[model samples]
Target: MKLPETAKNRLEDALKQLNLRPTQQREHVFAVLLSERDHPTADEVYVRAKKSMPSISLATVYNCLEILVSCKLVKQVNFDREPTRYCPNLAEHAHFHCNDSHRVYDVDLPQDLLNSLKSVLPKGYEASKVELSFHGTRVDTTPSK
Candidate 1:
């Protein structure tokens, strides 16, 4: 994947601030996430990143993602899944996952829903951030074989 000059510069700056050497494998993995819109798991990013960095290990990919997350270049998502996914968009937004395909999508819910959720909060409960996800499949779409 071709990473934009802005993304590369951002990555370079991040590595410098973190006092970490920039590597081809780490750059390739970071490029995959920055170049694509879909939030991807470590394995998914690894498959794409491996094209440019054949020697990159799965464990290495996970470690790189963790580093990126710590540097605020990437965000990790935990939504009742074994393998957490990472999002390149650091902006506050929600996601929806198609349970059938396991495809993730950004979501924009109604204001009423967000307001209603806050209204129902129990005592001593504070909503840090809203993360709403709707998991379902289209009625007419056939499931993967």
Candidate 2:
């Protein structure tokens, strides 16, 4: 998938600021992630990216993902006993895990909810950012195991 001009600019800026060398593999990997809302796993990304980079190894995919995460370009989500999922959205938002489908979806938190949590917290417990993930069985009769 082609990245938007603004998004591509932001990524290039990030790479330059971090003094990290950019490559075709890295650009394709990041673009594949940023173009989707589904929080894909490393293997999932590898499968998709392999179409373009036929020789790309799983290790290479993993290493590229780590680099992206370390640079704060991707956010990692750890769900119930599962491999880590990667998301490209950097904004402050919560996640909802659908137990039935084992899928993760973005959830918007209310301002009052955030304020209430902040107010009730003890002093010196500063909140710079918030990440809330709820894990539970969906309303479906037969939940996924």
Candidate 3:
């Protein structure tokens, strides 16, 4: 999948700023992530990237992901007993994990609510970041016969 020109340019600039050399593998991985907004694991990324880069290896995909994360171009989401998922959304948001589908969705929190949540911290305590996730099954609306 081709990346939007703006996103490609931005990513290129970011790599230059970080003193990292830009490569096709990195571009392909980033494109895959952007194309599929759904959070994907390293393996999933590797599979998708292989379609464009037939010789791409799993290790290379992992390396590309690590570089993207280090460059602040992507965020890694973690859940208990589950493989780490990669997200390109850099905004401050939470995640909701569906119990049945095991799918994750981004949840937007009000700015005031985010601030209020930080207000509960003890004195002299500071949080560099917050990761809040909700886990529940989606309500089924199908009629039962």
Candidate 4:
């Protein structure tokens, strides 16, 4: 499962920057995540990946994902006790979880606003990162037939 040259270059460059090996499995897994922006769990990624890499195993998929997260090439998302999901979007944003559909959507807030949210913390506090999420149902606006 080989990615196009440009895609391959990007993935390899990122791994190189972290002084990590860009193995075929790692490249393939990253391709799978990039192909679909939707946040998917390890099992979901494994299913998508094995389509091309028939010999790939669930454990390998998990390892690839862990490496990507540690390298900051992807972000791990968690909601309550649910299985962890992965997101490739690195921008500063929040997540919206739809209670009805159980889907996660990225919510973009201005840099200033996100910075101000830290004000709610104590005066002596410091923040390494900020995470915000909202849970709600999507209202159906379709008119009755």
Candidate 5:
């Protein structure tokens, strides 16, 4: 998949800021994540990336993901030991996992609200990150069209 010039520049700038060189494989993988906002597992990412780069190996995808995570360009999400998923969103937010549909949705909260969670932490203990998730079945509340 060809990334737009601005997207490419963003990726390049992020990598360069991290002292890492941007490569084709990394760009492609990142593009896949960008194309789909849903949190997808590595295998899912490999399948999507293969559509454009058939030669992309699963191992390579894993490596690229690792680098991206290390560079803080992407985030790795884990749901109770389930396959690790990749999330491109960098903002402070939570993930809601639908129990019935098995879909993960990004839920955003005000910065103040998220910061309030840190108050629960024990004194002298600083939280590096705050992770919140909700798991429930979605009910059909709307009339059928």
Candidate 6:
């Protein structure tokens, strides 16, 4: 998949800032993540990347993911005992994992709520980042006999 020139330029700039060399594999991996808003695991990324890059390997996918995460171009979402998922959304938000489908969804958190959450921290404790995830089943509204 071809990435927009603007996005490609931005990602290239980010990699340069991180003193990392931008490669086609890395670009392809990021494109795959951005292609689908859904958070995907490294294995999933490998599968998608293979469509564009038939020679791509799982190790390459993992390396690309690590580089992206280190450069702050991607975020890794982890659920208890589940495969780590990668998200390209840079916006401040949390994640909701459906217990049934095993899918992850982004949940926006208000700034006020985030501030209130920080207030619970003890004195002199500062948090540079916050990661919140909720696991539950989607409620079914259908009437049952």
Q: By summed lDDT, which 10 consecutive residues of candidate 1 come out lowest?
A: 130-139
Clashes of 4: 0
Best by TM-score: 3
Candidate 1: Cα lDDT at 134: 76
C-alpha displacement of 114 in model 3, angstroms?
Answer: 0.7
Model 1: clashing residue pairs? Answer: none
Worst 10 residues of 4 by lDDT: 1-10
Writing each residue's lDDT as its tens digit, candidate 4 over 1-145 gives 5566887787788889989898989999988998876999999999999999899999999999999898887999999999999999989889999998898999998988987799889988899888899999889999999
Q: Residue 60 in candidate 5 has what lDDT?
A: 95
TM-score of 4: 0.90
| All candidates: TM-score | 0.79, 0.84, 0.94, 0.90, 0.93, 0.93
Q: Is candidate 3 or candidate 5 better by lDDT?
A: 3
Clashing pairs in 6: none
What root-mean-square deviation over C-alphas does model 4 reach? Answer: 1.8
Separate clash counts for every candidate: 0, 0, 0, 0, 0, 0
lDDT of 6 at 2: 80
Task: Note the residue pairs that clash in candidate 3.
Answer: none
Model 5 residue 20 CA deviation (Å) reads 2.8
| Most accurate candidate by lDDT | 3
Q: TM-score of model 6 relative to the true fold?
A: 0.93
lDDT of 2 by residue, 1-145 (tens): 7767786677777788889887777778898898778999999999988887899888988988998888789999887669999999877678889878888998877888888877877888988866679987667588679
Query: Per-prediction RMSD in angstroms?
Result: 4.1, 4.2, 1.8, 1.8, 1.4, 2.1
lDDT of the candidates, in the order given: 0.84, 0.84, 0.93, 0.90, 0.90, 0.92
* Candidate 3 lDDT tens digits, 1-145: 9988998988899999989888989988999999977999999999899988999999999999999999899999999979999999999999999989988999998899899999999999998998899999889899999
- Weakest ten-residue segment in model 5 by summed lDDT: 129-138
